[model samples]
Target chain A: MNIYLRLVYRNLRANLDRASLFFELIFPLFFIFVQGFGLNGIVPPFEIGNGRVISYSLFLAAGAVTLTVINGGTNAGTQLWFDRKNGMFEQILMGPFTRAQYILSIIFATLIIGVAGSLLVFLFAFPVLGASFNPSLSGVLTIAAALFLGTVFFGAFAIALSVALKSSETFQIVSTFAFFIFLFTSSVFFPATSAPSAIQVASLANPLTYTTDIFRAGLFDAMTPTVSLELGILALEAVVMFAIAVIVFHRIRV
Target chain B: MGVNQLSRLYGDKPAVDRVSFDVERSEVFGFLGPNGAGKTTTIKMLTTLLQPTSGGANVLGFDLKTEGRKIRERIGVVQQQDSFDQGLNVETSLDIYGLIWNVPRTERKTRIEEVIARFGMEEFRKMPTVDLSAGQRRRVQVAREFIHDMDLLFLDEPTVGLDPIVRRALLDYLKERVHKGLTIFFTTHILEEAEYLCDRIAVINQGRIVQIDTPENLKRRFGSARAVEFKLLQGSSEALASALSSSADVTRLVQDSGTGAYRVTTTRPESVIPEIYRLAERHAVTVSSIYIAETTLEDAFIHMVTDDENGRETERGLG
Candidate 1:
């Protein structure tokens, strides 16, 4: 096997714990089912643009998948801090592996988990929301692109933070705080178009908003010129974040 | 393997200062040093886990700076720190480590079983690594390294946290591997271990190689003087200390305040003992038990390090 693939397998296998499983798989399901249904009656139907009205439950289903991807990416990246604490970072580097291979393995592992968890959430929400599973080739491409770019963006962002932070406690606190800020400010749970001007600006700056918007556009067959712009911005952020992660990771000692 | 004038500097301070040494094939080369003595730093540089600030090294015919990956492909290092997948069980941790080294699945299984039984990890092999005791965790860390094959192995204090039986067993296992053409770079604070396993030993102090020779040769060179210790039954230790202080053979004489025994370091214990007995008779004092202590590697290491410190202090004073 290739060294990168082997490292990816190691990362996946090492993280098959209950905590990772629950947060990556089950926590998103809770949001999709319990919170999505509970908010269905309280919040009115959301117009995702293109005159396609959908229940709050259906709207949150897409957000749930987005949240799952974010969680997967964050978990994958934070694993570096744990590896450093446990000494595996230096140990693996001592083996037949370069620094790039090691960092890429974590990114790829996050992609795998993110995509898999997103699919599981989508499948679970299908029955509850009574949503149809039909899409054109372009729509499928848009969804795939959104998932890929979203995962890479968050994974790289978390990795950069993990490397730049001096201690694990600070990493955890900052990552958790960042996760909540990203969750509430984005259009994951509610429509950003109806929010106040300041929140709208914050949502526009958040990559999660772009991911959720692109995913919602693809799922509802609402392809518009704005979705393309969102996709382009998400792709650019992913590239820049990945570059930053690589630069920060290289600066780490052992 | 050859290292020439290799050094690693932390800012302006040199952690390993221009240390040079060669390790031959199928030999257990021991690196013995006190705490903070650059043994770990040297091992890290040789194993490619750390980069040297200056000078050069050639490991297994490959340049250290340009061919680190090639060198890493053939060498295994057991670092001083514990490393493992804490969430994984002992078996899985070993298997994953083998996989990372690109070991074949069937061969990995075989090696895992062999190391498990060899290291006596059967009882806790199924338990998570985080749940194991310190000694057990250290055992797993050492055993996992054997899952992959390497030409040269670097062990930095590998016997720490192990019991006497396990430590001996590990040394014997390394000896077996060495006999089968595996070269070992071993570091340890245990003098007896160095004496029993190392074909040649290097004593490093203050980031420099103080001495490098076989265990027996080091003892012969630096610890040639035998120590004669005797307790006075009827005589005062002060009298014996004063009488032995004038003898040409007696280079060092000190009295133990707690035990009231006199210890004399001399070039010839045979001459010093009889002289002490004659002195005791003249003083109307009786000599109780008396014995000559053998010079060991520990004694030699202490003497060499102490001598190096004194030399440095004298240089500083003169400067």
Candidate 2:
């Protein structure tokens, strides 16, 4: 097996020992159920810019998937922090592996968690929401692409934060603040039009907004404005964040 | 391995000063020093974990700076810190480490079993690393490195929390591997371990190499002083001690209150012995049994480190 893949396997196995099955796989499913069931009754239909009405439960389920992927990004930082504290960071660097290989392992491992977690949310949300969810091959491909790109963007962002901050406590505080703010201020919970004007502008600039928008269009066949533009911006942000993460990780003191 | 003037500085202070040393293949080169004396810094430089501020080295015929990866590929390291992945069990930790080194599955399995038996890890092989005792954890750390083959191994205080039996077992195990052509760069503050295992020992102090030689040679060169102990029969030990203290060879003299025996430390044991007999004869006191005690490596280490510290202090005072 490739060394990077072996490292990823080890990382995933380590997380298994820590009982992360709940947080990574089940917690997001819980959110999906609560949002899909609890909000479906009282919440009204959400209207997109294209003048198409989508159920509030479907919209919130998409948001829940976004939350799952974004939460997956923080796993890389948490794992890296554990490695740092336990001395595996220095030990692995002293091995035959290069720094780039180490960073790639973290990225791939977190990417797997992101995709798998989001898939779990999507699967569980379908039963509770009772919505039409089956899609064509192209739709599945689009969802995969969006999830991959979004995972890379958020995973790189979190990896950079962990490396630069170098403290688990500070990283947790900063990442939690960023995760809540970005998720709430975007179109994850509600449409940007219904939010305050200040938040509309904030959601316009938030990457999560573009990611959730892309997911909504790809997974549920919901019509949203400027799908192509959102994807292009998401791809650009991923490349930039990933490049910054690699460079910053390479320069970090062993 | 060859190191010439290797140095690593932290801010303005040189943690490892211009240190130069060499170790022939298969030799256990012991690095001895007090805490923060740059022993670990030098090891890190040699292992390519830290970039040297000045000078250079070669490990397995690879340049320290340009060929670090090649060197890393050929060497193994057991660091001073407890560094196992706590989430892994003993078997999985060893298996994963072997896999990281790209060991084949069949071979990894064989080596894992062999090391588990060799290190007495059978009882805890299925236990999580976090639950093991410190010694058991250290055994796992040391045993896991042997799964993959390497020409050189760097062990930084590998026996910190081990019992004496386990420590000796590990030393013997390492000695066997050395016979099979493994060059070991070992660092420890345990003088006895160095004396027993090291082919040559280097005593370091304040970021500098103070002395390097075989254990016997080191003891001989720096251990010239001896302790001459005896009991006086019928004379005032105070007068005898004062008289012996006056001699040029005697550096110190003290009488034991319980035994009424005096131990006189001297650089010239032969001269001190005769002077003691002459003094006993003149004082009209009978001499009891007397013998010269050999200086141990611990004594020599203390003497060398303290002497270096005092020299530095005097130099600073002069400046």
Specify the highest-lDDT model's number.
1
Stretches > 4 Å off in candidate 2: A15-18, A49-52, A134-138, A223-225, B225-292
User: For model 1, how does the per-residue alpha-carbon lDDT over A156-248 read when each residue is reduced to its tens digit?
Assistant: 999999998899899989998999999999999888987889999999989999999999899888888899899999999999999999999
Off by over 4 Å in 1: B225-288
Q: What is the DockQ of candidate 1?
A: 0.62
**What does candidate 2's lDDT look like per residue over A1-254, in tens digits?**
87878889977876443456466666666666775668878987866545657777777888788787888888888888888887888888889988888888888998888888887777777776777767767667767778888888888989999999958899999999988898888888888878999999999878888888888877776545588888888899899999999989877786
Clashes of 1: 0
Model 2 residue B237 lDDT score: 58
Residue by residue across B1-319, what tens digits does model 2's lDDT show? 9999999989999999999999999999999999999988888888888899999998999999999999999999999998888788999999988988999999999999998988889999999988999999999999989999999999999999999998999999999999999999999989899999999999899899999999888888878667888887762456677788988777667777888888777678888889999988877787878998777676577667867887999999999
Interface RMSD, every prediction, one decimal place: 1.4, 1.6
- Please tell me which predicted candidate would have the highest DockQ against the true structure: 1
Estimate the lDDT of model 2: 0.85
Candidate 2, clashing residue pairs? none
